[model samples]
Target: MELLRNARDAGARNIYVASVLRRRRYRTLTVLDDGQGVDERYATLIFEPGVTTRHLNPTIEAVDPNSPPHGAGLSLYHIRNLAVRSSLLSAASPTSITVTFDTRVLPERSLQSTTRPSRSNLRATVENFARTSRTSAFYYAQPAKILASLIKNHIIHNDESAVELVELAEALGLRISTRTAQKIKNGEIPAIERIDGSGDGGRRRVMTERGGEVDGSTALLDLGDEQMSRIAVILREAAHASYVEVHDLRQSSRPGEITLTARVREPEDEYE
Candidate 1:
């Protein structure tokens, strides 16, 4: 998001972001944007777990026009849990929409075993066009598409020092002020959560509804902006770096039991 250039775009002209700290001393992040808003029909489903614009685009005619579930019910439900009270501000024009994520409760574990290997959608799109066409393909394309998403969303870079993210942002052509950089970094949730050694003698955090801790693949770290920037750098480093990603040291523990697993799979196979 070349801020100076993109600020004039109709889709994201009115975007604003902030962190709301609650009485319980928890954090709820809010993003108000003038992008194409979520339709009222999809409002209830936007935060439902696993719901995505990609899936919703294909099934508009299959379901009733007037219905409870617009699409995937789980992602929004998962969003509800992560952010506590979640909703689309959709305040003014249909294009102006907002999403709020609460940092009080825990994140979903259904996809805890899941790993999101990042890719450059912009490049992928162009590459798809190049396929079966010509050797002189989408060339010189670098980090522009992802850069726009990062800039437009005004990402929350996790727990890193302000100077760190700023330098990277400059590399990606982000013209954000230092004040905005601090704001983005401040929204990061802690990466290394303390295990409860007291209960059963440990202060353990559990994601399972049964109160049994699922120690493997928990969010040991949040992908703050700087972290995401680091990821972009890694992806750009390798032309073969399709779906490349970056992460910090993440560990999960419990007083009595803990689990850890790391594996890789092909593009079609899901990661666990």
Candidate 2:
């Protein structure tokens, strides 16, 4: 949350959070933002206690009394100390901060057991952040697949053209190009499948239809069920549709094709 708050404070419009596993034993978390680049001189200093470039805004303070004041810079200090290693690289635009941890390290047991961090925990954190954040945020897993995206609510709820919907789908790593999304919108291509409900929050799955073409014909989303369901809600609202359908293309007899569909329904037919 500190990393995200810092990005927002820096006037960033988009923020990306990514988690990567290396050598099967180490994990790295990266938060990158295309905000005003940090000066090379202060890149390392910003992590020090009581060192900060943020200025408190009266408007923001009025909205959230708990907003940090200027020079209250212990957030990064604590973050760095908790991680095995952390670094800030801001020589150019899109400042990037990375924190790495040794996943093999066992917790020191005390009177009570403690749960180690997992992907689900990360998802929950991001979801909570999305609910309140005003800027666009994206979460990605290793190999550059976007697992989830949080778009501004106004665009999702008010946009009439559905342009933002296509952007949201693309940000979620749906593998749909602008042209393809346009085709889907025009009915030239089949409707895209969407999750029916808040899915069973379980392990990530990469379901692909057998022999599916490697081109744009297939979209392999590696996301938990809850994230998928949240995305479906956004897509449905953006498209002004009642509900979107989720087709299990893996069960189809066709050798190499998959498709998604969405349809309009009566207001009374809406699902809870």
Candidate 3:
């Protein structure tokens, strides 16, 4: 129920829910949507209680009449606690999400998976995704190099200092605490490190523990359609390229390697 709500809130116009029988004992349930899927970065964070991307007073109602209309983020968290095995998959461009559940595994592995989800790690992931997806507008060949150049050319000068990043965040009207800024500068937050540019040229620098490397897994970014559009405009104008697109490089040699590619946006390209 909560998963459905999340998809609806993410501006999904079409949603599909499926269930399959596994060996007549285990049941597999799946929900697929064309909405603003969970960001590759926020996949696990969404399983944490009290974490929500929806507005404070979202118009969407709860799937259950007894549940609160707010705090849709808690839905999946609670469900994960009760369910057996679950996964969240999302992609950019089309902003598709697929959530699956394998209830058969819960009874046996519940004890082994009792550790609470990491809030700090989730916060860092979200912060990075927000900053980068909101800022970077284009992807190009040699994305990492181009991004580094863009930051040096426009966002930052040369020195990569914590204080400078904090100041930069403030200048851009983003709320970053001293501790958070320091963590980002030090690369403690492996998802995103810094965001640069203002107006139409906003860009973000993402850092990851595993750089440019993916083992056939999807990493979602927690960005909205409006945010991507603005960034595309900025990158398009700045790169002087006819095309601009954003993609998650799960298989990169560098950690947090977001590529800027040249693919002109069309009506069907809208993520929402």
Residue 3, candidate 3: Cα error in Å is 1.6
Error of 2 at 100 (Å): 0.4
The residue-by-residue lDDT of candidate 1 on 1-272, one tens digit each, is 11111111224333333323345344433343344555566666655566555444342222255544333435445546655445554432322222333333443122212222222232222223234223221221112222223443443233456676666544433334566566555543222221222222121335554664543312333345675566555544552355533334233444334333223234443364
- The residue-by-residue lDDT of candidate 2 on 1-272, one tens digit each, is 67777776776666666666667656677776666767677776977887766544322533477874633778889877777887775433556777776767723222221222343355445445555664544444331232122222121222324466465443432334556445444544432221111332222333344532232212443444675577667666765653444333222222123344444444555645
Q: Largest lDDT belongs to which candidate?
A: 2
What candidate 1 gets wrong by more than 4 Å, as runs, is 1-14, 49-51, 55-75, 91-272
The lDDT of each candidate is: 0.37, 0.51, 0.43
Per TM-score, the best of the predicted structures is 2
Q: How many backbone overlaps does candidate 1 show? A: 24
Candidate 3 lDDT tens digits, 1-272 = 45545555666543333334345444444444455666666666877887776664365342345655666567777777766555564443223233334545542222121222221222222223333233222221111222232243343343557666666443322335667666554544433222222332222334444452332111234334676677766765754454444333122232223443444443345556
Model 2 C-alpha lDDT versus the unseen true structure? 0.51
Error of 3 at 87 (Å): 1.3
Instruction: Give TM-scores for every candidate, taking all chains together and pairing residue i with residue i.
Output: 0.26, 0.48, 0.33
**Positional deviation of 153 in candidate 3, in angstroms?**
43
